[model samples]
Target: MSTETDPVRLSFRDVCARRLEWHGLARPSAGSRPADVARAMAGVHAQVISGAELGVGLRIAGATRTDVRAALWGDHSLIKTFGPRGTVHLLPSDDLPLWVAALSAVPPPREGFPEDVRMTPEQTEKVLAAIAEALQDGELTIDELNDEVIHRAGSWAGDLVMPAFQGKWARWRQAVHLAGMRGVLCFGPNRGRKITYTHPGRWSPGFEPAETLPALAHVVKSYLRAYGPATPQRFAHWLNAPARWAADLFASLAGDLQQVEVEGIAAWVVAGDTAVPAPVTPSVRLLPYFDTYAYRVGNQPPGLLYPGRARDRVLRGNFQALIVDGVVAGLWHQRRSGGRVDLTVEPLVRLDAAQRDELGVQAERVGEILEAKPRLTIGTVTVGGHA
Candidate 1:
């Protein structure tokens, strides 16, 4: 457990600790082709150990909203693709087809949508083609893009048609993926707008495309290396992929991986893997809502946060989290008005003075990032355990 006690054979917690140093800052490109970032973190669940850095860290590191977005998708194809929950996710470009192929294996559970409403693979292909044609070399704002999509799909042909009769274009996640493919959907350029759509092919020239299997293998390897001391089931959950396919990914990575036990459960870690060291004592981090680290756990051990509660909050359009000693020790929320950011902290356990000091400092820093300061208020600390 101590850094002095053998640097090799990192525990799950240990692996999570230094992830930011290795995976984010020390990267060759400071984590460029941000999609590669997902692949790198995939070694651990395709979730970065750091999750969404809070406002404090952003100010301290001089990272803006644009920087974070760029850092997350530098070269990856899809941001919100398949994962354990059929939710949107950021994925590496090379692994996109494989992930799409794997997740598309079984039709997603049809819930409220009628069976007749399902779009077959052929139909989806047609949709993609039409979309590609309309957006291939062009850029459109969200409204313009939606209109183009409706027009190109011929969904707006007649007024008598039922709203349900129109074929759906891309959902939030898919639209982002299409943008990734086109290259115009980049950081800024759109500048703090919602779902700004652009052509990727026009944005970054001379982009290199990696092969599918190799990319898949790389993703599998990265997850085990970064997040390992984890299992295939955990990975399948993180990727929103099939258990069998996760197992296959593990099998393909046999020679490059090693297995270990944490608290009596079996898991795998990459051989020769070393963890980045955290401060001698644990540190606290203020994380943004929906940070990848906050959501990567898929019904597994070393439980990080309140998944059910987090999911509920996200569904309700609200969430803020805190990381203590490299784990999601609490949830938080912020309110911004009149150029001031108000922070509320609800911890699962009691915070010592040191933790409070660290948390307060981080909170102030985050406010600075948004150019909103002191009118910064730390709400009453609520004490409770994470369910």
Candidate 2:
């Protein structure tokens, strides 16, 4: 009585364990290659500089903040750009060609831009073109980029400004992301405390635009290699793209992927990537807000969902997560006061002596990365929210 949608297949526990391998949480291969890790996670969230560093550092073998920084700013091997939901991320430099080509093809969200700063598709294209010219062989902070856009695109582009977290952002400010999505611009080294922008083509010399279909296929394979046995709907959600687009892309590549069942639901992963490994050693990870894995699969992360307990999903809008052996077990905070960084953790369950000691070491290491002495404190975790 097995059907495609309800096939007897791998246990939920097995699925969780395999996913941990994909996320570099399980017993993973030893390597400090940033490109490999970035490709694995699809991309790493980089809105918070330190968090993104910690997120990548934890996943890669013996990676350091210096290594992440060098990849980002020094070596120019990792391109910082906005991807999926228009959020900032550190994507591997070599992969930029395909990533941008496919992402640019995704139609804008149906709700469209706010009336206060709406744009025609033609207007958006012009803004992207102007941004490419301004950012060539030089860097500009958001403020400077805004002025440059108006200078290049005319005063009308300036009128396309909307209130944002920092200030009113011009319509061109939005399409500047399109410049990134189209493989033109990326983040440059910060001048003082303000972030700057530049051309990815200059930073990553070999960059060239690719065909959309092949680029979509490459992205799909990359995604499945790290987070597979996924449905088109999930892929669409991950990229914040229209459902029809993702479905078409997946269908076109159906012969290339292997069909598998995830807890009786049919899914597809890159061919030959379905092999599950042994369970991961129990350990704890202190992940910052917006950690890529924090956006776990299904309702909960693989580790949290397996072993069958009546528990809710842990990923939320904003909260630093404490993950234990691949499951989000709690939330944590680190704040610097004077010369000391206070580390506060709210554990969902009791920790043994060994676990506590392990946590202390992790806390001290976090302090080292932030270049401050750490003070560790463990508190009781309540049913919901921070206690």
Candidate 3:
């Protein structure tokens, strides 16, 4: 156990390097343990299937997109759901029980929604029940599910036109996604151009909603192991829960974690993993949108890595990061057409021959995941220009 007053001391580089190892980038052969990568990194960002595949594939030594697909849709080892802040993530299916319990323990965040946009307590419950019933044994498209929701719950369920990136919702599957945040609904495989939804009970028949502090403790502990040396505020934001609640949870969990100092910043890691990690390997990465390495790396490092304007430009709207060694060195984007992918990397610093070679390897890894002809462009390198 660590006291708040006497945290173990460390440098910024130590934290950065440990973050890389914690994320599974340091492993020489990660393909053999894809589950370990998801377990350690927490989950794979999966708003885009290709990005999610690359997110997992990048950490693994020789993983194919098929392998990742198998884990989700075939072998059923991983599942796609609205995890951590209502974003799509591919989590190990076995951990879904704990996730449901942890998320359920948090107070509902209705206060944040605008008065006009917020669903009433009754409407929320109706929405939840409608979603689970509609998707009980069969998956349905959001549009199909929305129709079912309106049918079962009432016409009012169709009244809201909520804002969404896949265009305006104008339906209750929007609330079904909120129901997903509550851990009742999850994403099913795409049906042609449309996305589908199903209940986890169908996939993991063992799933049962049980409120338990130990489950939330397991959730927080798993987070600390991968992205720890983290603050309570960071943990709360990650869960989209109230900060004070997170603080209380941390206070209750002191025995399982240790306080640490990173360049004067106070953070916590699992008590069993308090030792400083060895130096980071000179690894290059073509990280995708919401890659846990880029998205869930806490809040402070972005300002340090991207600085003033870089953070806004590179991080906003699900952009990818081009990491050199252990920090954000640039931004990257990908566009796929038919059987080809065009990837553009904008590096912040000039690349040495070795760095460029490693970057090519990283790009090739991304290409392998896409199963498309990859045309990579290394744009003129500069620092923080896109932030």
Pick by lDDT: which candidate is best?
3
Q: Which pairs clash inside model 3? A: 31-61, 309-387, 310-387, 348-382, 348-383
- What's the C-alpha lDDT at position 240 in model 2? 81
Root-mean-square deviation (CA) per prediction: 7.0, 3.7, 3.2
* TM-score-better candidate, 1 vs 2: 2
TM-scores, each model vs. reference: 0.68, 0.88, 0.89
**Per-candidate clash tally:** 33, 1, 5
Per-residue accuracy of model 3 over 197-292 as CA lDDT, tens digit each? 888888778687656887888888888877777888998887778999999999998688888887888888888687666865456777776673
lDDT of 2 by residue, 69-92 (tens): 888878877889986667788898
* Model 2 steric clash total: 1
Ranking by TM-score: 3, 2, 1
Q: Mind giving the per-residue lDDT tens digits that candidate 1 earns over 1-387? A: 112223244455555555544444221242244454455555222223133323212422554444445544543243433243444355554454444444434233424333444444554454455555666665566566656656765553222222233654333223333333322233223435554444434434544344556656655665565556678888776665667877877777666776655555666666656445664343676666455342356323434433444434332343456666655566776667887777787665567999888778677667755557634344543433222
Better of 1 and 3 by TM-score: 3
TM-score of 3: 0.89
In candidate 3, how many Å is residue 58 off? Answer: 0.7
**lDDT assessment of candidate 3:** 0.75
